[model samples]
Target: MMNNGADLEQCKRLIETSLGWGDAATWTNEDFDTLSDRIFEKTSVRLSISTLKRIWGKVRYDSSPTTATLNALARYAGFEGWRDFMATTQPPAKPSPAHEAPPAPQKSPTRRFITPLIIITITFAVLISFISARIIHPPAANLPLRFDHRATSDELPNSVVFDYDATPMHPKTVMIQQAWDPKRREKVDPYGKQHTSIYYYPGYFRSKLIVDGELKMQSDVFIPTKGWKAIIIGDPLPIYLSAAETTLDSGRLSINAATLQAKTGSPVFNSKWTGFFDVHQFAGISGDHFLLRTTVRNTSTVEQCLCRNVSITVMGKLSAIIFPLTDRGCISDIGLYTGFTGVSGKDHDLSAFGCDFSQWQQIVCAQKDQTLDMWLNGRLIYTKPGNRSIGDIVGIRIGFEGTGEIKEATLQGGGVPQDLLKQP
Candidate 1:
């Protein structure tokens, strides 16, 4: 195929086939958008929705797509680049009917092909009916699923491979959920033996192996003891901070507004704001029995309709306790998950969790057996039963949605509350 006319047409055909478009004329904007998203997920580079539309001939105008865009699509399709894809997958050769001659019959048509044709039709019908029957009456009761997973390494940017047996049930609907994020959910063939995924950050993660929307098996993955890492989310990218950039004053790891602005080149009052602090010395902790004590204060003003919000996450191997703090009137969207059923601000009204966040306030989270309690300034504010292990505590993460200050923090395995009135 030449680059001028037929080559571009061939590229369009390849994209359409890769996207499973039955008919090119019926391709919708949403379909192109899905293609763009899939491409970005597989490769880090994102192609604009408009660029995809033009490539698919959904919109008018175009010089050839830039080399970068072509390379991205090629990488998305598992090739080295646009040139590589073209070199490996050549366009189909067209037939020249004008140069062909009529064939002479060697035998009677009915005698040679009629009997075989009838047999082939019957076999096809039987296969379709068998498939239809399976669809109509799907698997009942859970499949005898055996699931296991292990990581290639127990460090940052680790890859974990999950091995499972769910082939006895519906093979098409088997999926592996890597984390709480919907984007982490991946569909796998039930008949397939294994699936692998990589963890970009360190924490306790509960991975689920699901069959037909039902959880067949669940496991906890803990990436342990990587020291404290701090990050500030810069939308699609994250700005990482070194230990030198942060200070330890008293007992608190200090990250003030000035530090954030200098590192990110932007103020903390922007629409999208995030500051993360993680420590990885919690190998012996569990969500079922642990104590966390901290006092946080936000120096930024709450005058701009946004409260000084700070979140503390005690991450366990299979679950986490998240507390989002804001002003007395703002809402809290905290969560605790053990196999998809735990506490979340969406289901629990957290208006009661709000307080004066501008001043330093004592915060405590503790769990004893199946009971979990939260206390603010020695006053028990929230209590919830049905406490289950989210997983073994691998670490803790403290995040700020705006400019905030950490006065002091401590974690104890268990027992009576540490006296906040007594300075260490």
Candidate 2:
């Protein structure tokens, strides 16, 4: 059996491979942040960016990760837990042959000594040659780089065609990252002029070009939905809802519990979520300074979904603003995320976001200059400073643990008003 250290290392490697994000050495701070978010989304366990960085050796920490952390990592990798992962990773013992071959003769002491000496000399020579070659030919620098993209369509599952010029850095592999998540990165031929990547969801994305492990250039790739789209979040792929499957009437948009159960093929809504997305380019709404007002409530009456959680997300070009709400007693499980920072209820007092979801509740989020404020039921509950600029607001998403309804939604900025329920 492998030691604890070896097993941990193996687990890290498997996570990296499953993520498909190039190499961990080339990952940036934002990559780690994205990793933490993805892990929470899949496991409902939050691992801070600092913790993730330490696990990947990006930070200096003397102690090993806690058991809870290891279990979370294993679950993110599709295992039952750390113990289950270890059981599967252990190598099976090999059986000995019934009739073993007789031993040959032993080598002389002088031959053994000579053999080792010769091998050492050859290894030393090869190491010297490799070092000398690297010194003689260093990587090229300051080449004129160009990266840009064009979306093939204005809908989900849209493929974007990228036009790049990296011929000056030939022989070096180039990477095109679809968004902030490094897992979306893909290698392209250095000599090729174009590359294509498909986006499974609609949102504002920043595409980047990397060469020699350095960022060369980046461009914006915006894929807008044709209209409001409903979906049930699923593993590997989400179950999309047709327009006929949703109810958009009487100035509200909603999905019933039966529809969610039918789409997910599950009776219990423990972690199942249903979302409505209105993704498009909001011309005058800047993510840094805007007001998003919406009336929402959880409609799940299932016994298993006691938390009755719901979240509102404003998708931006650089990052997003996610505000969550839950039943008063389940406040510890909610979290708030601004583009640049995040706060969890487990560590902070987020009781203001807790309320009764049996009736409609109005939530308002406003960002001005460097401050962000949140209000529930027309009462200001949370205020935070140091809000970073996240570029233009491109889309909005509302998610519920099981089922929910949006009575009315509006986004206002730059002296313009947008009705989120109405199509452009």
Candidate 3:
């Protein structure tokens, strides 16, 4: 990916510029795809995702860029940035000692010894005082408190604007907040459904939701005398069919198939369809796994009738900490091959394939009264607990496993209405 030194510099600059806009942790492979392709299209050398990561590493360490790298970097930015960066980062080389006249150097051994002794005595006195202090005044009942404040890369003044990407998991709307500046805010999918915040701290960056005066999702900081921490309240629960309001902070909602997105008051995140996955019925640890059923109304001019059962692939994750995110395909880019799928081994291999994450998540589809379990090929794999919890889900998908489709469809969930599932 690093060809000419200049090309490398240009790529690095572009990446830094882009990272300046959003959360670096939330970066997607698609972003790299776009950046690399654009660089190649404009210039000749190409950069890969791995290459981009390496450049970021350099920036983290305050390293200098070579001449060739700088020139290429200049291509991606305004003249001012590239020019200023080059001038500021590069330093003038020092002349070799050999090129200058040699000077006679002498030092007094007695003076050196006296100075060293004086400094050593002072250091010893300070150490003695510290030890005495410790002995006389021990720590309180609780240990001394320490707080880890991570810094984020968000700029000084925060900004917000419309997101016009046709992608699936991005915010239809946005909420920009900066500690220093007045929020530069705008709403795009005021009708589409959610907002996102790229929160910048001094050390780490978090792309989360800001309290829309409307969604009032707020949390309290319960820092004790021992330590300090703030719980995130303006946050949605983990992605579950049972996602409910932790409190009355209006913005809490599942970012799945059933909820209507009011962009103006959209929470913090939404589905950015990077690709698709199957959601179906199956048997499980909880019981009849997921109830897979959907009623497809003829929205198209022709007869809108599906024929096969929707295939649901469940990936296993130990922790759902990074469970729901904007970067969808980053976790399973290649083959999704674990957990449970389709049906197990009764009549047919009703089974589809599955993938697993370090975190845990259950994918199910069902209604209030009815239940649906997993079937791979035709074999029953798992049956889930409860009913179809996917909020107001109307449309179910099946293309995640190569080229699959939901054949039979019916919407009978006790959640929200079925018609709300259409793409806005």
User: Runs in model 3 with CA error above 4 Å?
Assistant: 1-97, 100-104, 108-110, 125-424
lDDT on C-alpha atoms for all candidate structures? 0.69, 0.82, 0.32
Model 2 ranges off by over 4 Å: 1-143, 302-304, 414-424
RMSD of each predicted structure: 14.8, 11.0, 19.0
User: How are the candidates ranked when ordered by lDDT, highest leading?
Assistant: 2, 1, 3
Model 2, residue 238: what's the lDDT? 84
Candidate 1, residues 152-178, lDDT tens digits: the string is 996556799898888766467788988
TM-score of each: 0.55, 0.65, 0.24
Error of 2 at 353 (Å): 1.4
The best candidate by TM-score is 2
Q: Candidate 1: lDDT over CA atoms?
A: 0.69
Worst 10 residues of 1 by lDDT: 333-342
Candidate 3 on 1-424: residue-level lDDT in tens? 2334564455555556654747555565445545554454333346554455555552253445554444444544433345665565558677798887567566589887998999999999999999996776554333321111222323322222212222222224433222212232334342343343443111112122232211112111111111111112123321211224111134311122123123213332222111122222212312222234321111111111112111232221110000111012232322222222112223333223232222222333432343334332233344333322322222223221111112243323232234323314
